[model samples]
Target chain A: AQSVTQLDSQVPVFEEAPVELRCNYSSSVSVYLFWYVQYPNQGLQLLLKYLSGSTLVKGINGFEAEFNKSQTSFHLRKPSVHISDTAEYFCAVSVLLRRFGAGTRLTVKP
Target chain B: DVKVTQSSRYLVKRTGEKVFLECVQDMDHENMFWYRQDPGLGLRLIYFSYDVKMKEKGDIPEGYSVSREKKERFSLILESASTNQTSMYLCASSFFFGAIPGSGPEAFFGQGTRLTVV
Candidate 1:
């Protein structure tokens, strides 16, 4: 069985400031990594996914994540966050099945 | 664009009543999933179907059942609604026709149904 761990539940940052959401996973076999975003009252939208290849993968909305195999982490980062970026983010891991962490609430204050 | 539609956007049900949540996907995807979202907790899977008449229990499938009589429709049944079951239910579909060893399936989500159990 695989499990996803999201260390922080809430992250508060000012607009135009950089932000990072940490995620880690544990699994015996190879796994797939995904980041999903959820706006208020809305369903989950795929932010990005890392299946294989280059460690760094760029996703929509100028958001990107780096897959650090040695550290067992896939953290999401945005150099300059916007007010519109305020939302909830979830980190998930899928090996033969899927598992999700609690979630991180990003508050981009002006 | 992939389209997944739920039967209702909001619903209110009484405790001990049987509740049905319907979902349809137009992409003809082979994999359909039912999940519920709540504050703090992210999406937790209830059930999933890989093919017609085939179903598998997910992490939280204790009080729920599923039906997939057709390729496009998957239904989630709550045998007895409870206050704990009130949540935002989301349905997703993916083209995982042949679940290969390393195949990564990208899911498309529905708008979601906010179910309130009274």
Candidate 2:
């Protein structure tokens, strides 16, 4: 079985400021990592994924995440955020099945 | 673009009523999943199907059942609707792992149905 942990429950940032949402996972076998974003009243959309090879993965909306095998972490980051970027972010791990973290609510303020 | 569609954006039902939530994917994927989302709980999987007529119970399947008689469509059933079951229901589909050779395991999600049980 695989599981994900998102350290922060909520994060608030001013417009154009940088932010990072931390995530970690536990699994006995190798697994794929993913980040998903959900806008208000909408379903989740894939932000990015890390299958193999590269440890750094870039996603939509100027977001990127780094896969650290040693640390068992996949942290999402963005150099700058817009007000429209306010949403809920989830980190997930998948072997044959995928398990999602609790979620990090990003609130971008003016 | 991949499209996953849910039958309703919002629904209201009385307690003890049987409820059905329908989901369809146009991508012809081999994997489909049903999940419920709530504040602080993220997304908890109810069920998933890897093939036509095949189903698997996920982490939280106690209050729900599922049906997948055909490809591209999966249905989640609440045998007896209750206030505790009121939440956002999401449907997702993806190509089976390595099914498309080089495709990744990324699932496409629907618009979600917000079901309120009274």
What C-alpha lDDT values do all the predictions have? 0.89, 0.92
Candidate 1 C-alpha error for residue B98, in Å:
5.3
Model 1's chain B yields a TM-score of 0.94
Predicted complex 1: CAPRI docking category: medium
TM-score of each model's chain B: 0.94, 0.94
lDDT minimum window of 10 residues, candidate 1 chain A:
A92-101
lDDT of 1 by residue, B7-115 (tens): 9999999999999999999988888899999888888988888889988888899999999999999999999999999999999888772355212457888989999
Q: CA RMSD for every model?
A: 1.6, 2.1
Residues A64-100, model 2: lDDT tens digits: 9999999999999999999999999999898867889
Per residue, candidate 1 scores C-alpha lDDT tens digits across A1-110 of 88899999999999999999999988877778999999988778999998889999899899999999878899999999999999999998987667888999999999
Error of 1 at B73 (Å): 0.9
Between which residue pairs do clashes occur in model 1? none
> Candidate 2 — which residues are off by over 4 angstroms?
B98-104
